[model samples]
Target: MTRALPSGIGLMPVRRPDDHRPRLDRLSAVPITDLARRFSAATPTSARDLDRLDGDLMLRGFAPVGTGVLRRILSRPSFFWMGKSFRRVDDELIAGHNFFTALGGSRGLPFAATIGPSVVDGRPAVRIDYGDPRLAGPRLTRRLYDELREIEPGLWLGPGFLRIGQRRVTVCWFAVDSSVGYGEVR
Candidate 1:
């Protein structure tokens, strides 16, 4: 025999558990027109040629070290919001992959991570990995860029070269659009 609840009592439906979907509150959608406008306004015509250097960091061979570099950089407070994984596809190669809220906390900064052969035609011409955040200051950005150029000249100044073990890596500087929620490096 089954027992019935009181007429005045209300029954609440049980919710089925599933894969956790990240809340959209943390993600901001910025208009493309606004991004373009800001890009043009900030960038100079002389250095505009650097715009073509954009793409994903394909970890085809250097998966371990590449992943380590990403992890190390993300560990910092500046890049705390940059999700773990890098860009997987090559659809609209602007600077790096569009980081869809994967890793980091609520206040985490959103940026792109790309590694590939080159930075040609804005498709990662060489094996380069870049992280650009909107929160970083101009001085900090310049300092990081200069440091990279000094430490790993091969990875930064030169074309590109693969590192077998745990070696120092370079993090390039890029511009971030807080209004729209995206970034791009020079």
Candidate 2:
């Protein structure tokens, strides 16, 4: 039986890949979206093209590790939301993303992201933007562009700024390998 989906942002075509289907009996009761988001991640190839990325780091934002009081402030008060998995399919990049709710809880919101390959300041980079049906009216969701660069082997970084309402904050964006926190997330 097909259920008519509720209208809102971040809901997509739920025709997921085989790797995204169920496997764990322990988690059988969990919603398919939650389960799929956790299991659907891929790792990026160490190449210069965005189209070639099969998967990449599921970025978890920690305490802002940079200069300026604003950067610290932007990251401190809000709880961190991490996207554990990202994969490329037919030129589209899909992320298993979680978001911080204003009430201090976090939830996963599946959405499509657009990544453009380019050179920024002579460094290999890709410009990333969350596509339409975005999280609206949120401080972190509006007015943003993520510029991710290949910093090292198996490492990518997004040097981005976010505008929340009227205030803007420089965001610390970078993702480590999925194995970095395997025990914690898995």
Estimated TM-score for each candidate: 0.19, 0.44
- Write model 1 residue lDDT over 136-168, tens digit each, in one string: 323322122111111111112222222224443
C-alpha RMSD for every candidate: 20.9, 12.6
Q: What tens digits encode model 2's per-residue C-alpha lDDT throughout 83-168? A: 33455533544333433433333344333445544322333345444323433334445366455543344444454546566644
Candidate 2 lDDT score relative to the true structure: 0.37
Clashes of each: 18, 3
Question: Which portions of model 1 miss their true places by more than 4 Å?
Answer: 1-92, 95-137, 142-186
Which ten residues in a row are the worst by lDDT in model 2?
A: 16-25
Candidate 2: residue 73 Cα off by (Å): 8.2
**Alpha-carbon shift of residue 18 in model 1 (angstroms):** 13
Model 1's alpha-carbon lDDT is 0.25
Go through the candidates in order and give each one's C-alpha lDDT. 0.25, 0.37
